[model samples]
Structures are given as C-alpha cells and as structure tokens.
Target: MILPALLGLGTGLSLIVAIGAQNAFVLRQGIRRQHVLPVVLICGLTDALLEVLGVAGIGLVVERAPTLIEAIRWGGVLFLLWYAWGAVRRAMRPEALAAAQGSEASLKRTVLACLALTYLNPHVYLDTMVLMGSIGNAQGDPGRWWFALGGALASLGWFALLGYGARGLTRFFATPRSWQILEWCVAAIMVVIAARLAFGGIEV
Candidate 1:
C-alpha cells in the first residue's frame, strides 16, 4: 500500500509539475490574488475526478481510441500555440502598472476560465486519466484505490502550494517590466511545449 501510494504520489506530482495552461492560470490568479481558493479547489477536484474515472477503466478506452488520441494531441498542440501567441502579444503590449492594479478578473470568470482551461485541454484527461490510470491499474485491486488517493492528494498539495506561493511573488510582479518578462517566459514555455507536442515523438 505504501509503495502504491508513493508511486501514485510521484506520478501525480510529475504530471502536475508541467507548465501547462492550467498551471499558468493558477499562477496568474495567485499573482492577482483573485479567486485563489476557488481556483485551487477546482483544479484539485478536477484532477481527483479524472483519476477516479481512469481507475474505473476509462484509461483502456482512451488507449484503444487511437484516432481520438491523435485528434486530442493535435488539438492540444494547436491550443497551446494559440495560447502562446496571446501571451506573446501581451508581453509585447505590456499593460500599464495602473491598469494592472485596477484590473481584477471576476470570480465567475475565473472559475469558468479555469474549468474551460482544465477540461478543454484533452491532455488533462490523457495525463490524469489515461497515463495515471494505466499506472494505478497495475497496482492490483484495493491497492489501485490507494494509488489513486495518493495521486489526488498530490494534486491537492501541489495546487494549494502553487496558489499560496504566488502571493509571495506579488511584490516582484508589481512592475510592468517584470510582467513583460514573465509573459515572454510563459510564451516561450508554451511554444516549446506546443512544438514538442506537435512534432516530437517523446511521450509523456
């Protein structure tokens, strides 16, 4: 059970650590200090829900649906590219510090944005359900649940820390130049991930 839990934790953390749109949004919300808890809760709950679905044999379905997988892969790639472009545009057009100060994304918008961000990306299902599920399924009966629980816990832990930690960086992100640099970095990461997804054979 311990081994299964540890494996699940490692697997869960590994996937969560990736700099994807979901994480980007979470970090952005954290920096803005708007709807932080809601954002974290939604992300963590979504992860847990997906993991449960996967453990219930949805992973096999995904594996068998190669066409669906390919479609999602391409879709994810395109979405990432599009998102990267937006980030680059923002970087280039750096928002005024005063504007940044007054602008606060509504809670409803934040929740909806996060839901769309998490659910729309097929990669989330691929990673949490298919990939993580595959590992959980190998754990044998009751142990699989333990593994899944571990993975869910990891999501909870990581997202909470990420959202909370962003508060500490608010001072640094106050400067317009800092936001520009951060946006550029976000764009670079998104583009790199998109390229790898579109053309690279390396599997997650």
Candidate 2:
C-alpha cells in the first residue's frame, strides 16, 4: 500500500516537474505576485481530477477518440502561439519591475488562461490520463486509489511550491532586465511547445 503510494508520488513529481507552459505561467504569476493562489489551485485541482478519471479508465476512451485529440492539438497550438506573442510584446516594453506589475492580470482572466494552458495541451492528457493512468491502474484494486491519492498530493505540493516559493526570486526579478529575460524565456517555451503540438501526433 505504502509502496504504491510512494511510487505514485515519485511518478507524479517526475511528470509535473518539467518546465512547460503551465509551470512557466505559474512561475511568472508567482514572481509578479499576481493571482498566484487561484492559479495554483486551479492547476493542482485540475490535475487531481484528471488523474482520478484517468485511474478509473477514462484514458482508454480518450485514447480511442482521435478526433478529440485533434481538436485539442489545433486549439493548443493556436492558444500557445497567441500566448507567446503576448510574452514577446511584453518583453519588448522592458519596464521596471513595479511598472510591469502595475497592470496585473485580472483573476478571471488569469483563471481562464490557467485552465486553457492546462487543458489545451495534448501532452497534459497523455501525461495524466494515459501514462499516469496505466501506471496507477497497475497498482491494482485499493492500491490504485491509494496511488491516485499520492499523485493528487504530489500535484498539490508541487504547484504550491511553484506558486509561493517563486517569491524567493522576487528581488532578482525586481529589475526590468531580469523580468524581460524571464518573459523571453517563457515566450520561447510557448513557441517550442506550440510547434510540437502542431507537428506531433498523439499516439493513444
């Protein structure tokens, strides 16, 4: 039981630790001290819900539906490109840290973008629903549920850390140059991810 849970924890961490669109957004919000709570909450909770459904076998149905994945792929690509453009535009301004934070993202807008980033990407589905699902189900019976729990906890813990712990770098990001660098990095990530989403095909 404990072993399965530990396995789940490690697996979940491995999946979530990667610096992708979602993490980049969360880190940016954290550094800016803007709507970090809701951002992390939505990300963590969404992952938990998706993992639960995956462990229960929705992944199989999703795997069977190529059309659904196709829709997500195009949508993700467009959305990511739009997001990347925004980052690039922001980077062009190169304002002071306080000036940059002056126009903080609204909660509603932030939440919606967070949701879009989480759900639009096909890799999220692959990582959570298919890959994590297969592993969690392999734990067998009650162990599977325990595995889900561990994974959920991992999601929550990681997002919380990413959202709050980012403040440690606040001083560094206080300078506009540093902030511009971060935004450029974020834009690059978004473009790369968008390219992959556009060109890559989902394999079950």
Winner by lDDT: 2
Alpha-carbon RMSD to native, per candidate: 2.2, 1.2
Best of the candidates, TM-score: 2
Model 2 TM-score, 2 decimals: 0.96
Worst 10 residues of 2 by lDDT: 95-104
| Candidate 1: C-alpha lDDT | 0.84
Per residue, candidate 2 scores C-alpha lDDT tens digits across 98-187 of 586767767889999999999998888888888888999998999998898888999999999999999999899877889889989999
Angstrom error at residue 20, model 1: 2.7
Q: lDDT per residue, candidate 1, 1-204, as tens digits?
A: 898999999999999998878888788788878899999999999999899889989877876787776777777777677778877877887656437646887888778868867775667888888998989999999989999999999999999999989999999987888888878877887787778777873354
How many backbone clashes are present in model 2? Answer: 0
Candidate 2: lDDT over CA atoms?
A: 0.89
**Candidates' C-alpha lDDT:** 0.84, 0.89
